[model samples]
Target: MKRRHFLISGAAGAALSMARPSWAMAGAPAYLTAASKEGNSTWLVGLTEQGDVVFELPIPSRGHAAAAHPFRAEAVAFARRPGRFAVVLDCATGKEIARLDSPEGRHFYGHGAFTADGKLLLTTENAYDVPDGRLGIWDAEDGYNRIGELPSGGIGPHEMIRLADGSFAVANGGMQTHPDYDRAVLNIPSMKPNLTYLDAQGLIVDQVEPPADMRLNSIRHIAADDTGRVVIALQWQGNPLTAVPLMASHRRGEALAFFDHPETVRLKQYAGSIAISSDGAEIAVTGPKGGHVLFFDGATGAPINGRALPEASGVAQFGDRFAITLAGGLLEGGASGGKMLDVAGGYSWDNHLVSIRRV
Candidate 1:
């Protein structure tokens, strides 16, 4: 501890400064997440840059991902997929300020993103009865009200990212399922997974689809670098023994390039999470089923390296490298080398992790 204590002090000061006007002092945003302990207690947690826990608040149910407000030290914790509830909390005070509920026939897909201006919140929703994907809009300036929604361009929208040009990219997993069926995929013979780019108003700008033979590859998770290049992770819905690419990168006006790692065959065709390094030069991904973390070159489909982390699922930027979260703890490598860190608090980590920059 000496290092922990020092970083804790700095983080405390940062938290205090966040309460003041941004011109007076700007406190960097802490990493926020939802973690569970033995499936009993689920919490939304904040941590400093050095992996120190700053605050933890018990959520009513399991949370899959969270999005931090750009200006205020606030966060919104999303419930797991097929969920109907999400909680908005004040990170500084650890209080629940609001709750977002799905409309009568729709449910959340457990992920969301905020615009740079922080004026609106966007979420992926599924109209189970009508069987379509939607982008739920909320009025941030007006108390998180459900303002309206727009079409998400395809079915089973899982994750999305805002681009540098004020647009959105969605990963349409292309599988149809209803909560009543308990995660049983309803469509397989004609599953049409696609990566769609939408304008800020939610109009389809463009879309990319895999070839005829790769339809079983579902686009589930996504990450983008500072330069607006997007990388997507795939989960194979085909046979267990068949091997396929688990990752792909997309650039505007260019075809999607599948990362062809001769060793990707070992991933078992499942990647739970995806994240880019701080410098935008490397992409990191993790697989819970295969118990491994792999890195790919940002510009090429070449595999840089790989590491093993049993039950590893979450991948996020950690300083110069990326961190992997598992039941045992958090690993700070998966790039150069793997080093264990103590941030799990003896809890089982969920599938995705993200870094937040306050101010």
Candidate 2:
């Protein structure tokens, strides 16, 4: 991939002086996300699991999500989907260390993950001209250089996560989009969203899709539990009133076991984000469009419980429970039955809430 990389003017020295040796410094955050306030100002934020803000760094534009390095106090904040840029920040000093630009005809899909060793960064991308999905590999240990690319095994790969065994799983949302058309779905009738598993080298090991009848259900967001079973969130691209299965769980070499309980139908045909409990026993799917958060048994795909939360936008594992973010700056459910915390500061949380686990 041909692109430009820049160290923020004059911040290089500060980065060298203040960069932490590890993520054990005071105020090391447990979660990372992107938020936006008035006038389109945006920031990549770090927070403790209990809703305390650890740090916030400015970004050039609205970001979709961010990838926290497993070992370092650094993050790569991705511009919203189809956006051409991602900024790398040195969290210890709150400095912009580097900038990544997509090559011609390719754009970031708004999400990425660092390898377990924190030596490599793998990002989801759109080879839009080919209408294909690509994984951009970067040398995280060497100034975040773009080293190579890999096929994503399908089209429209959105979110990618490193699995327990060092492989990866990706959600290929399947609806083709191009920046020229500005997020318009180009092939609704033929859309075939799928969840694909890749070996450590990025070769497809296994892939599966929703039942043929649910072909229009776009597989967008995904989360993996401790056992390597993946839970996926879907957005219906067909009739809004239709009650189709919106969540499913899968293990490689096994068929997708869907969670089609009655509550799923109430999600308004869209699941905006998903999370698997740290213990691998529960799952949460947020439907901002439907105005609710639904829980399910992580192993069985059965309904556990759900709650109505207006404009709920992001969800991630927080201890035994899940932390949820709502529009208007409200963060709740960080701990089991925990009270709500208003951290909005006039900014709304974006689509994904990422946990920064120690390697």
Candidate 3:
């Protein structure tokens, strides 16, 4: 299949460009990113297949996660800190239409999604010292008015996703912290790591717990394909210094080990992000510790190939290509500590979105 390429231009001029090589599959995608001048802000850049930044939208907060409205051209972005509200932006015009406080609290470590009809927004709240996790609902019509709240099921509800059955699947990383950002204390001794499936009204419909041996692993980020299968990314709670392999899959009530590649498995510390292709044929997981993107067959859970990327902390699928945000270099007091350090070699910023297409 011949790949189509598009050029994306920024308000200034050519920001970036993407080229879809012909060797790529028929449905494969090419991606481009628009980065922000301030690393702490949610800068939205629309791109063409040729990797050009044609339009840019500057969001008010450091957006940790985003979900495109199911049917609308707009998208919802969740801020990390300082700015605690989940704001909805007009993807086309780059305007803020609605902003509302997240029921999950002032510090949401990147978790928010939109309902199937685009009528509601769901997210997990993480306020330090606050043991209770909040599941917040916002009415999309009234500028994201808070309608209700529910238990996030566990402490530190970091990520939440919707299932095919119209239920909510959440990764409640069982850890406790103070909302002031003064301290982050982990509760490893009594850690209960599990996947909770909730009904539309936030009722627990099904629960799948990790194996007894890896109970200390905290399930963090989750991604679902068209078939309703889920792939969860885990962050270590028992020991941040320990390298543990805890990547796996779950469907209905069954759980299975997916990526056991020695090189990939050894990256227990780098399980920061996971994304599945729209058609359910490909899955990509990023490991900042390993500085690589691992690709696997979505059905078999077997490693296909991997690509080297910068310290990628977030991953997303734009059309057919994969988009990754590099934050490793953004850490304070690192070798690349200077403000506006060159990232991913050519891409520079505290936060940058890079799209990968097969050559």
- Top-lDDT structure, candidate number: 2
The lDDT of each candidate is 0.77, 0.78, 0.58
* Candidate 3 lDDT over residue span 57-171, tens digit each: 5656455566555545455666653347665655544566676664434455556666655567776776554666766666554456666656677777877887776667888
lDDT of candidate 2 over 98-175, digit per residue (tens)? 999988889999988776656678889999989799988887756777777888878899988888887889999998
lDDT of 1: 0.77
User: Using alpha carbons, what is the TM-score of model 2?
Assistant: 0.90
Better of 1 and 2 by lDDT: 2
Q: Is candidate 1 or candidate 3 better by lDDT?
A: 1
Candidate 1 segments exceeding 4 Å error? 1-29
- TM-score preference between candidates 2 and 3, better one: 2
Name the regions of candidate 2 deviating beyond 4 angstroms.
1-20, 328-336
Candidate 2: residue 117 Cα off by (Å): 2.0
Residue 58 shift from truth in candidate 1, angstroms: 1.7
Candidate 2 overall lDDT versus native:
0.78
Stronger candidate by lDDT (2 vs 3): 2
Rank by lDDT, descending?
Answer: 2, 1, 3
Task: Tally clashes: model 3.
Answer: 17
Model 2: clashing residue pairs? Answer: none
